[model samples]
Every structure is written in C-alpha cells, then in structure tokens.
Target chain A: MSTRISLDGVDKTFTNRRTGERQQIFRDFSLTLAPDELVAVVGGSGTGKTTLMHLIAGLERPDRGTVSTGGTRPRLGMVFQQPRLLDWTSVETNVRLAATAAGIDTTEVAPILDAVGLTEYARSYPSVLSGGQRQRVAVARAFVVRPEVLLLDEPFSALDELTARRLRLLLQQLWLRTPRTGLLVTHNALEAAFLADRVVVLGGRPAEVVGEYRIDRPRPRSPEDPELFDVHRRIVAALT
Target chain B: MTVTHPVGAEEVVLGGGRSPAPPDRPPATGTAARLTRPLPALLLVGLLAAGWQLMAHTSDSALIPGLGDIARNLADITTSGALGENVRVTLTRVTLGFAAAFVVSVAAGIAMGRSEWLRRFLEPAVLIGLATPGLVKALLCVIWFGVSLVNPVLTVALAAAPALTINIAQGVRAVDPALGEMAHVYRLDALTRLRYLWLPAIVPDLFTGARLGIAMAWKVIVLVEIFGLADGVGYQLNLEFSQHNVAGVLAWTVAFALVMAAIEYGLLQTLERRAVRWRRVALR
Candidate 1:
C-alpha cells in the first residue's frame, strides 16, 4: 500500500507581480523517496520546502521535469501549516469529508479520531478546538483517508513548544503503527530529527539538497536522545 | 500520552474564552423589566399613531386620514378580497423577478470573480446598473415592453441584479486560496468542493445579497406596477390616489409593509440563523 515518489530535474519559477523579476525556486532539483519511507525536508525560509511538497502532492506541476509516484498515482493527504479544517464542520465530519473524498469507508474516522486523542472533540466544530486539538483533527483527517502518501507542511510549527513536542510524539506513534510514504516539510531541526527516518536539508535560492542524514535509530526514539541532538546539530549546520 | 487539563477548562481556554460574557443581562426588576422588554418598539409605534390622529383632528384635512379610518378601509378591502388578489399578484411578480436576478447575478458574479478579463468587461455594466435609478429603469422597461407583466418583472430584475452581483463577487473573491489548496490536495470532487467549500465560503455574502436584492426588487416592482401595470398593490394605491381616498392608500401601504416585515423576520432571518449556526457557536 506504499508508493515511492520521485521528482526528476524539476524546474519551477515565480515572477514578482510588481517588479516582473522572475525568481527561480527549483532548478534541476531531484529527489526520491523509498516506499514506506518517512522523509523530512528541512530548510530555511524561502528555500521552496513547501513548493516541493506541493509538487509531490500534485498541487503544483514542475515547469520542465516530471514528478511520478512509482507508476501508480497514490492518494495524497496533506496537512498544512495551518490546521485548515473546515470551520463550519465538526471534527469527525472533517475527517469523514477527507475519507469520502478518497472514496474510502467512513467507519475508519472514529478510530482515527480516537488514535489522535480527539474522540471527545469529534462532534465539536473546529472553531472551538485549541490549536493543538485542531492539528490533531488535521492529523486524523490525513490518516482516515488511508492515503499512500502523506505530506505535512510545517504542521506543528505554529504550536507552543510543549504542545508541539507532544504532537511530534503522537505523529511518530501513528507512523509506527501504519507506515506510509510520508514527506514532512519543516524548518525545525529537532522536529525533523524526531519524526523523520531521513532528514534532507535543502538550501540556496534555486534550492538543492545540501545534506542528507539517515536516522537508523529504532521506533519510539526519545526526543531527548543524545544521538538525536548530534543529528540535529548536523542538520542545522547544513541549513546554514 | 494524552494532554491533560481541568475537565471543562479546555473548551474555555481553547475557544478563546467565551467572548466576555455578552454584556451582563439587565437586571429584571419586576414589572419594570417586563414592560421594558417589549415597550420600546411598541411605544414608538403607539406614539406615532397617536400623534398622527391628533394632527388629523386638528388639521381636519381630507388628505390626513386618522388611524381608525385607515383600519376601517383596510378591513373593507380585506373582506372584499381586493387586498388578497392584488397582494398575490404583486408578490408573484416580485418573487419571479428576484429569482431571475439572483440566478443571473450569481453566475455573472462567479464568472467575474474567477476571470480577470470577465471582471473588467462586466464591472462597468454592473456599476452603471447600480447608478441608474429604479424609476428610470421602470420607465425604460415600460417603454420597451409596453404595459405588460414584462415591465415590472424586467425592471425589478434590472434594479436588483447589480447590488447582488457586487456582493456575490466580493464573496467569491474573498474565498481563501489556502482552503482551495487543501481541497485540491485532498482530491475532493467538484460537487463536494462546491457543497463543503465554495458554498459555505460564500453563504454569509449570499444571505446579505439575498436580503438586499429582495428589498430592491420589492421597491422596483411596486414602482413599475404604479407606472404601467393595471392589477397589483401599486396600481390599487394609484387608483385610490386618483380618487383622493387617503385612507384606502394608507391601508394598502400598511399591508405591503406588514408583508415585507414578515418575509424579512420570519423567513430570511430564520434561514440565515440556520445556515450560520456555526458562527453563533464560534462567537460564544
């Protein structure tokens, strides 16, 4: 149920509306994700980390090259920097909407809500939920779709540090339970180190992979692990 | 591990703390409270009616009908069935014209909102339509189509559509691109996107436009009827005017106002409450 994602020689550019100056974000950039692999893309601001996720999610098309998902197109579920829940819909309905869109049985929504610690809030509208709770709903939404690929763009960056840490753990636990081709784009080095199996540091104006680090530590790894700090240090260095 | 908080505190803290308790309900001081509860509006109406009656008594002018005479005339017309027939005819014209305007305005609004070229091309026409008076439009429609049902309906549509188009266009433009991206990534079908995303996004604006459009349509239809049509509320008012029957005119005008008030409060407000129940909860 896993799918490998590959972006080959992808080129994307945007022109300033007022200045008419074209800024190239990705030029001959390439990367590949092994099936069931969790890759975290870490980068500084404006390094096109989000654009890369958009490319893989098919929200944006590469200007010149192709982005393929190992022959078969996988059902993609995305979590944005904001929770992006439908404010009018309840938590359970939000998850069910994604499941419906993916053409899957909605029976999975209850379990996913439970998994994300949102069972009590299932019937509550997103507007009433805390920031952390809303993100949990988003996580439940992404998982309930039974997607082959999950793309998260700075999903926990907006939360308080304590809340973000807890959610990172929750996300890790979920990934351990049922692995998918996961791509997490974030600027937080520690978060990247904690959840991703491989950390890919992207840098420069026309972004390219500056360094790649593979975390071979086993599941349920501690955020406070000394080895994680070392890896975090190296990723931060690569980012600079 | 799950995050823990005091049982009921999470909702308060998370919901940004209940919007400051809604300005403490005024203390219920016995009969004073009960009297004040419904008194302000009723007192105003009562005062206005009493003042008009006094003025009619003092002036002894035929044009200034007292409240009693107007009520007697209203009862006469109601029993005679002219009031019902004319009301039905006018309501029919208003409904048809408003419906046509709404459908066309929504389509044109979405088109203009989505396409820059369409917006530029259609914006001038909408502005001109808004600037033109209902009387002018009514007269033009009468001139173009003669003294038929077409004049009132066409005039109402032309008068109401511009404001509705502007409202719906603003709604469409205000739709969040972030949500659009979320919809795309989730692979929501066209129908689902419209139902869950696009429709909800524009609902507040839709309600606003509907209220404004219906009010405009009512006004325009009455004007058109006065100028051209032979059998509607406005025509009845005109007939009463020609005979110098001020009581008859006032009765018809009061009945029309009552019907519009019913539609506004009983129908539109109820629908808007149901549609935007989430907003109420969010505010709380």
Candidate 2:
C-alpha cells in the first residue's frame, strides 16, 4: 500500500570535528508527500537535500520534530548517488537481498531485473557491469522490495548525459507501473521537471521550500516536451 | 490525452548502447610467461644456498656450518622423530596463542573503531603493548608463570595482540559509511548486516591481522620457549647453542621457517583468495 510521508518542523545540525564548527542544515523545515505521489527536491550543493532524504529514511533523527510515514513504519527502498551495490554479490542476489530485508518474496527479483533490462546480467557481479548497468541493478533492487516509500538521491547524476536521460525514462516507467510515494533529490532542475509529479525547490541557509511546481502532464511524458522546458526554466529560476 | 508508449520503445532506447562487452575472462598468458613467474624466487634461494656453501668452505670457523653439516643434522633430528615432536609442540603453542589473540583483537578493534571514547581510552594500552620488546615479554611471562606451557602461550598472545588490534581497528574504521547507510535504509537485521555487510567488508583486514598475528605469535613463542620451556624447537635451539653445535641450531631454525612458510602460503593465502574472489574480478 502507498504511504504518505511528512517531515514537520525538522531541525538538524552537523558539527565539524577538526574545526569545531557547528553548521545548521535544517531549522523549522517542513515538507509532505501525498500517497503515491512522486516529488523531486531540487537544490544546490549543501542545501540539505540529502539531509532531508536521510531524515525521511530514518538514517538520521531530527533534533526536533518528527518524520512520519502516515503513522505506519513503511518499508523503504533507497537508490543512492552511487550504485552502492554489494560488489561481492551477484546482480540477482543484490535485489533478492533487499527483498528479503523488506520481508517480500524473493520471486519478485527476476521480474524487476527484467524490467531494468538486466536479466542476462543477473549472475554477473557489480564489478563487471558498466556504471549505467550497475545503477539499473540498483533501481531493480529498490523496486523489488515493493517499498511503500522510495527514496532516490541523485540516482542518475553520476552517469553520462545519454545514459542518465535513458535511466530517467526508465525510472518514470517503473514508477508508472507501480506508483508509490517517492522522493527524488537532485540538482538537475530539468530532471526534476521531467520525472516528478511535483518539483519543490529548496534554498537558503537552514533550507526551506523556495518554490513548488506541479507537472500536470500525463504518464510517459517526453523529455523533449516543450512544456517540460517551461517548467524546467521556472525551477532553474527558483534555484537562483 | 495520456501518451501511450510501448514497453518496446523503452527497450529500444536501453539497447542502443550495450556496455562494451565486459572483459570477463582474464587475458591468456603464454607458457613461457607462466613458467617465468617463479623464476626469480627460485634463483634467489639457489644463490643464497650456494653462497652459504662457499662461505662454509672458505671459513674454517666452527660457527660457520657447511650446508652438508646442516643437512646431516636435520636428517639426524628427523630420523630420530624429535623434529616432528618439537614441530608439533611449537605449532600447538602458536595456534592457541594466535587464536586467543585474534578473538581479543577483533573485539577490542571493533569497540575502538566504533566509539571515539573507547579508542581514546584504549590507545595508551595498545601503544604500550606495541612498544614492549618480545624478549621482555618472554622474560616477564617466565617470571610470572614459571617454566610451563602457560609461559610461552601467554607471551605469544600478549606480543601479537597489539599489532592485530591496530590492523583490525583501521579496517573497521575504513568500512564505507555509505554501505552502513544503505543497510540502515534497507532494514537489514543485525545478523544480516554482520554476515553480508560487516564481515565481507572487513575480510581484507582480518587476513592482514591474522598474518601479522601468526607471524608475531611464532616469534614470541620461540622467545618464551628459549627463555623457560623444557621442550620445543626453540629449546632445542638453546641446547645446540650451549653445545656450540652451530649446524644443529641452523638445521632446527630452517625446519621451523619452512613450516611457517608452508602455513602462510598453503593455508592463509589460499583462504584469502577464496574469500576475496570478487576483488580479483573487480581488479581485472
């Protein structure tokens, strides 16, 4: 079942060990996602985009306030900036491990691998796969869990332009097939506009939502769609 | 209207650039290349043997034993079955001591690596342990425990634990934080994290610590044996030295070294290769 995620009045701080400098990343910051909605968070470096994801994923706790998934502890699947696959494990085993962790059936692994076009490389190690292929396996791993909330932190930014573009389309397709609550944190405004049901731009010290835009376009929207460019332009303007 | 796109369209895009075929198989080597691989080590051993023989012939000193003399003494010990008994005794001591040291080091290493306060608290003890000479430890063990089995075993464990602890601590610290984060998000249970993530991640370090620990254990075992114990390869070495039988001492030393080398190459390295096979593929 899909789940709604909300972070209310969250506060987070990081202290530098060497310099003894305390930097506040989020203060009184809040955001929410409707059930089965895909929201992309776009911001510059050090704007707490990742911190926001971490707070939602329960990797970090807020100094104040609560991050709740509709009061239910929903299964979570995350795709990091790096593929972050276990190099020792096979592609199929990687997805199966996530499924096992989520208490889902391991049988879902093969179809997800097939969905990512990595069926043949199931037995191959992460080392042998190309960067894009490894990232595809990561996507398969996240989806196979049937997680109620999907968190992707700049999942395609490491790839070259062409591969990133294709993966963006692939991610959109996967989401369309099994829509769930999703948060994609990226610096790419165009990517945010192309994939997210809503694009929320975060900015300033102790980051807050600077702008929000809804993509009213239907599923399988083209990257080349002129309306996407207009939304991308507004996102970039908000970013500045 | 919703845009209708076929799954085939996505496949066409994904198929456009197949990643250049993975060089899954390593490049084949010629017979000549394979044959030459061990040539340097073999040549060095041969040269050293020849040089030692030449020295024995040139020098009439009783301390400089000839290769033939050493071989004859080695044969005498082997034929009398003393060699095997002494080797077994020494090996048992080393193994027990190393096992004890390994368990303590891994536990302490993980604790120190995971907690800053523990690291700071334990740093002085580790540094002191590392700085103490093996000979001093052996003498202290002899004084504390007398001429018994506990003397050598305790000395070996104490001497070896510090270096292994440092190695394992570094490994624990070096574990990728990203993977830990991934594990957290995935909700992997504690046992699963240890098995699939922590154990595999620290395997290289474990091997490093084991190798260092075993080597140090061997050295400390010998020291304590020579200092106090009545029987073992090291005690036999002391006996030969007291009798001024240089060849006897040299023969015993060579036999012990051969056993250590065999254990290292035959057991430890083979296990390491199997555990980290994924690394070999990644490197290729």
Identify the candidate with maximal lDDT: 2
TM, every model:
0.88, 0.89
lDDT of 2 by residue, B167-219 (tens): 88888799988888888888888878777876677888888888877877888
lDDT of candidate 1 over B1-284, digit per residue (tens): 12122112122222232222223334545987756766776798799889999999999988998898999999999999999999999999888888889889988987887788999999999999989988899889988988877788888899889989988888988998888888888888877877788768888888888888887788887788888889899999999999999999999999998889789878998888778878777766
Name the best candidate (by DockQ).
Answer: 2
What are the DockQ scores of the candidates, in order?
0.35, 0.37
TM-score of chain B of each: 0.82, 0.86
**A72-183 in candidate 1: lDDT tens per residue?**
7788877889999899878888899899989989998888877777777778778877898889888888888888998999998898876777677777777777899999
Model 1, global lDDT? 0.84
Q: State the fraction of real interface contacts model 2 keeps.
A: 0.33
Residue B116 displacement (Å), model 2: 1.7
Say which candidate scores most in TM-score: 2
Candidate 2's error at A20, in angstroms?
Answer: 3.9
In model 1, what is the error at residue A148, expressed in angstroms? 1.8
